[model samples]
Target: MIKPFSVIATRLVERTIRINQAARTFYACEKGSIFINFGVIVVPLIAVVGLGVDVGRGYVVKARLSQALDASALAAAPYADNVVKLQAEFTKYFDANFPSSFMGVDITLAPPVISDNGTKVTVSASAILDTTLMSVLGEDTMSVSASSEVTRLITPLDVVVSIDTTGSMGSSDGSGTRLSSAKDAADILVNKLFGNETESDNLQVGLVPWSAAVNVAERGVSYDSGLNTFVDGHWYTNNSPVPFITEPDSDWQGCAYARYTDNSNDDDADHLLYDADVGGTIWEAWEPMPRRVVNPSNGNLYTVRCPEWGISKLSGTKSHATDAIEELSNPTGTTTIAQGLVWAWRTLMPGEPYNQASIKSNLRRAIVIMTDGLNTSSYRDAYKGDLNVSEMNDRLSAVAAQIKATGVDIYVVEYHVETNLMKSVASATTAPYYFKADSAAELEKAFEKIGTELSELRLSK
Candidate 1:
């Protein structure tokens, strides 16, 4: 009855249950071991990630410090006349931004480093920044250095502002129209060159208004005695045989000359004569006035005395230049860069006779040339016909090169020039400062940039 088969079956079932329990215990032990092993690897990875975050923050601080330092260095350099002041400004700028970094900074300034006849200065600033993360990798500090050279800009600035008063200037670019925008920029530049207050006698500016030919401003008339007599509200010469300006009650109440250039084809050139006299006195008739010697090369000269009158002073009085601009209502002339460059040279060099060596040497010589179009005219060729714009550009490049060689800094501003030709002219400068203003907004910014660069920094004064 208690069969042997039944007992054997029961024994087999007990053995199977014991084997399954042993396997489960072994599996649990292995799983715990694997978890511990994996945690060891993950701990170091998290620490490294945390370190990277701190490193990025440090980099941002360093970048900001670099920018602030550059600006401070330029400002401080002018004040740093000697090594002592140089060190002081360096410390001031450095400490203001990176207080801890520049604590023990090493500054080295070489002699003759001071500019503006030693009233302003220049020096190299260097510092070591301690690394927070890299230190653990055996590198502790990173060395950084910045060099600065600053000279007082307060010296004489022979600024020849070549403005495009062509027909296009009347079009809206930005800050009103091109002409208005240019005047705005010009006013700022003038203030900077000749300090806003009492501009020194050393600084002189020649404003060249160019459409087809450069119009010599009233300011520059004295240099060319011929041009002065022609523009000073006179028909023929001031001392003409007919006597335009006689004693008191002369029959001719001093005729106002024709405002339009005689060569213009407009019928109004003959019909309407602008009253040149301040009191509106009209000249009797328009005779074929002799050509005043505009070009000495052409063998013509004006014998009359050109009056010395300023259109505007430091006090901002009535501006004849402004009036001249207003008079140009229908400005339809094309641009000729060659003539503009030539005029700029004339203002600076004044040729052999009027070249003042003292002014050239002591003062800062500079030319700010800006144009929206490529050269379309040449002195050798007439501008009216279908001009080979490229050929005229070549002539312009040559003229620019000639002027740059005379030791004056040329700042070339291209409003919308193509790549190839713009750089060619810009490259001729000793210190090439080039800009491309494509839009009206950009043009305004371009002018602001020029004004900022042209500012003066007086040291001794």
Candidate 2:
């Protein structure tokens, strides 16, 4: 007979095994549900990451667009704010600024629009950045745009046009003869300034034609009463006057001699220019030039002439400027570029000795020196070419700095010739205003361009 307790124990063991199997099945089903939920979450996560990458690219493109637009607007602000004229410049600068290639990017530029009576210029541009990862969101590209504006202002300006009329200018080239071409260019510049039908009370122009010497045309001057005059390699003073030329008082003829510049102390008032008596460096002792005047009364006697073209003071009238340019003549003498520069500066000074230019308010004062050769002149009274070629360049560089220090800018135009020394002279004031011309037309173009630059072209915005 089987015991009842044994059968009950067997039944208990079987029930425990079945309960454990059911628990494992429930766990397996719960694990499958968790994996399915993860699959759904992964889709949005990928989209979020793609959105971030594509949006970042879009922002970069937009930033670049803004920079290009701003640059274009500033460049075009100088014109009449005419969109047609500005289009080329706008595209050119924008291409230069945004010079890199973007992946799947397309750029479009809208024409500039003028407002505020042709004083304000506005530029609009747009770019489309194609999506890389976020393209799955039914969006192919993101559109971005930039707009910029600038106001054109009229900056008050003054300019001095100085010419080198040395014998070398007699050389002929493809631009016609140098002197003739220079005259044409100067006339063109004057017409561009005062004859453009634009009211120009704010504009004034001066002409200085220089050679071995400069003539101020009968002006009062102050000079150093100390140094003696050197004649034909002989040094003497008025106390022992050597009667070779006319007296300084009677036949002085309102001409200025070069100023003595002591390189050791050129900053001294004695070295200062626009004064006459500072050792008579301007004129070369009134010597006989190669040209002879056969007056019957004088009986073939030699006559003296200053080694320079007469100066025309700063004037606003077109006739005044034209007449001045027409009077430029071929003279036989060596080159004295420093004297030319000094006298040009004199024409722009405020008081004493050629007091033509004055500044009560802000103005753009500039000097344009056009030369075809190297500087071959020096402070004859004191230095007298003691400074070699290299040394002379140093002296000119110092003088140019002095002029620039007094709020004047210097521009150099090298025609039919180019040299490192001339470039240095121009760069002493500001960069890239130095122009080189190999032909006659090119020379004229250079002057016209400089004239345009000296005019008022202010970016107001």
Candidate 3:
């Protein structure tokens, strides 16, 4: 214990060196542990950030794919019956919505799936997105997929087709008489609407062959005093006899003039003429005048003839409508578009003379008025042929407004001529509701389009 000073000093120095070596070894161990911990934490953190970015990109691609799939499904749903057409439509809409190099991702679209006897359509697509950050985790790419479904459901629908049977329709429209072309076009529409079935539970169609006046009598459309209603007579004048005609009420044909109380008051006159209320004004029976009226256009004397074919009330049987349309021959009368439109509107009403329409709240009513000329005649009363062209057209427009207000879509198909009134009436329903067909083929195509639209294509999923 009692060693020399040099020995004590050497021991102290050795002890100090040993303590410094221990401290250095401890510091090196801590530094090595920190470096190992940083390596472990940073690698995972980078991977997690990359996963987030890649997953976010995957979600974006999936959203876009969903949108494109939906569009494709809806576009192809209408053509479910034809495999060729459905495929064509699906590819067209998908290409329009999603490009080949969308978001730098590779895309593949599957064929459209049609089921439920062609009533349902399903569209699916997928995208292969190359992963940037996720590659470190052994995921080189991510697959995102989406699908959409559409269903073709036929809703309760009532359609009234009012065709002009004016004399001008007898003229040739290149291939055949305008009347013949119109008949062919109408047949196409009915065929499309009915499809393979002769009758449908949810579909009802009515035909209104109109000229200077409607022939309601031929259909036995008359007012019923016992029921206090006009049975089968849509909006017919209530308990009114023929005016200005010396013939007895029994001799009155089923033809009726437009109702009017006071022509001097424009508002009141229009209200009386266009309003469907049965109690407002009385409709007078049209009787052939003893003297023929002078034809202004040809300076020849001609008697007015009611359209031979009467209004065909809404019926589920396709043959009933076709039969009425087939009888649309001998076009020989002045144009009275207002009368035709009003009669068609009455056919769609649930409570009127033709109460064939359903009282359901979801019923869809539409009026397709196909005319070849302008209004050349007025109501069959005092101003029968006295009103000028402007007055007649104004009346037609007023009636159109009233019809559209009742939530009935009005489609105007102008054949061979276009008019401002036709455009305005069609626009009242919506765009593309107005179709101008210059030829027979165009007319057929227009009706086909309308029938397809009315079939009611919707997305079920």
The top-ranked prediction according to lDDT is 3
lDDT of 1 at 311: 18
Give a tens-digit lDDT track for model 3, residues 123-210.
8887777877756756676677788998777688999999999899999887789999999999877876775557778889999888
* TM-scores for candidates 1 onward, in order: 0.47, 0.61, 0.69
Q: Put down candidate 1 lDDT per residue, 1-461, tens digits, no spaces.
A: 21122232343355345445644554566555766655544444443443454344444544655655555566555333245655676667755765554434333333325543443555454444454543443444444444445555555556666776666667776547766666665655554343323434555655556655543223322222342233354334332222223121122221122222222222221222332232254543333212232434555443211111211111122232333333333343467666566555655564321243234467666767777775554222223223477755655666666666666677777766644565565644222367776776666566555655665543331
**lDDT, candidate 2, 1-461, per-residue tens:** 21122232343345345545644554566554766655654554555556667666666777788878887777665444235556887888888988648555677888887774555678888776666665554555667777887764455556678888877887775545688888888877776455233335566678777765665552113222254465665433333222223334433322344433432424322223333232435422332122233445545644333444556776656677777888786744456677567667777666544466747487777888888887664333113223466655665776677787787888898887887777776744333388888888788778767655665444443
What TM-score number comes out for model 2?
0.61
- lDDT against the true structure, per candidate, is 0.47, 0.61, 0.71
Which of the numbered candidates is closest to the native, going by highest TM-score? 3
Poorly placed runs, candidate 1 (over 4 Å): 1-70, 73-153, 217-330, 352-360, 377-387, 427-432, 452-461
Of models 2 and 3, which has the larger lDDT?
3
